[model samples]
Target: MLGRRAFLKLFGGSLFGLMALGGYAFGYEPVIRLDVTRYALTPPGWTPGLKLRIVALADFHACEPWMSAERIGSICAHANGLGGDIIVLLGDYTSGTDLITGKVGHRAWAEQLATLRAPLGVHAIVGNHDWWHDAAAQRSGRGPTFSHRALSGVGIEVYSNRSVRLEKDGHGFWLAGIEDQLALRRSIRWKRPFTQGLEDIGGTLAQITDDAPVILLAHEPDVFPAVPSRVSLTLSGHTHGGQVRIFGWSPYSPSRYGDRYVYGHIVEEDRHIIVSGGLGCSIMPVRFGVPPEIVVIDVG
Candidate 1:
């Protein structure tokens, strides 16, 4: 019913818009940005006049169309250049969907992470995806999860509901990590063979000195609420900063507690939690509004 010229004009404009959006999602947003957000924490045991830098990278989700092995290597190489005192990885190493297996890629990625130089140490913990995939693998006789093998192979200690000390000049604080939130609950729900002492936060804290300031690594931010006041700081990444934020806020964050602690630094009374926007996408390869990031927190 319209003239040919007008119809062609409208069609051209729509095509251009779709192309631009595709470029943003597949090309620019994922590859161009690797934000290094900084935060200052005032933990009770933080050394007066002494500063410590901790670098946290979460939700690598290594696979094709999102994060490749080379991309993961480059990310770690960049983090190494930052010269952080401690490097902590907050899990979700592989994608949940089967678009990419990520087995070989993960191994290569771990090798690159091994080269990281941190004064204190490098530590990591499992996320829900890791547990989920691992569970699936076990059923098929694929043996234990690649996470334990790859991460530990590089000397990056992986902790599950346990605490360890990071010493510098004989002065230090306690760092603890818990298993994936859903995995812990799933074990109870299915009444399957449960791992003893899994996610026993109280038991983990018991190992540390009463006065020692604790830094907890919990992959999912939902665990933030249960973390005690004794835990001075907690590092987490699971919501992916909502992945697709609108109006500087997201309505679809994957959390039981909603977007309260979706991303960046959050202070609850005396406790502090820093959730990274994360370095990779989940479910879909597209990321809008929220880009990949590596968070750096300095405490003193």
Candidate 2:
């Protein structure tokens, strides 16, 4: 029904728009947007005077043209300057060795991340990508991955199906983490469906009793419902805020629960989950609408 000139004009316009979008995604969006989202957490407890500031960083792919060492260092600097009481790292430190740029390695990334400091402490958990590359070693009784050791070397405790009590000024809260979802499966071969890892929420919870308030560090938000209501908050970062969003929706969310837990804060009853957009990209190094973020949760 359209004339020849009209078709040509429309095609040309569409082409131009696509190119512009690609350029923005590949160039500007990845670097320019570093958002610091602040969330107020008023959990079930009635401690009106209690306040805690937690800075969460996740999914620093740590490779390629996007996440160079300099950029990672800069991100850590910003995190340190944020004045958080505690800094928590959600995983995905590296995509692939092949994707890494010059003068960057797992050790370097770990060292840079080590610079992140807070009065309370720095804590971390591994992601699916971390297990993907080293599942065999991690499963073959090779102890923790080298990356895990690197994190621990810098005083950042990597909690794998474990729990620890964090105390400040006589107020204490339970901080726990489970193994990444992929690590718990029989095998995490590439191209296979991601089954739930052997996350021991009960065992981790058993480490603490008397309900002093709980915050869980899970690499994926899929573990959200598995967490008991005794937990006040859960922090996850594997979704990358859907990587890209259209009118606040991302077409490709790497979550079994779909976009329901894709990004930001999701509150169900008294429990809460904060999914960070994360610091880097996966698959394709492009982000649109949903920029990388460092989430700040203020609990009182």
Best by lDDT: 2
Tens-digit lDDT track for model 1 on 1-300?
Answer: 979999999999999999998899767887667878888878755556656789999998877756777788889889988879899999888775565544446677788778777888889997777766775543443323678678998898998888997776656778999876665323544565653223668888888975656889998888788888888899999888988887789868888678899988888877788989998877766677889998989887
What's the residue-level lDDT of 81 in candidate 2? 91
> Number of the top candidate by TM-score?
2
Residue-wise lDDT of candidate 2 within 81-137, one digit each (tens)? 988999999888877335435435788899899888899889999887776666664
Clashing pairs in 2: 184-197, 184-198
Error of 1 at 174 (Å): 0.8
Flag clash pairs in model 1: none
lDDT of 1 at 181: 67
Clash count, candidate 2: 2
In model 2, where do residues sit more than 4 Å from their true spots? 1-9, 96-103, 135-143, 184-196
TM-score per prediction, in order, is: 0.87, 0.90
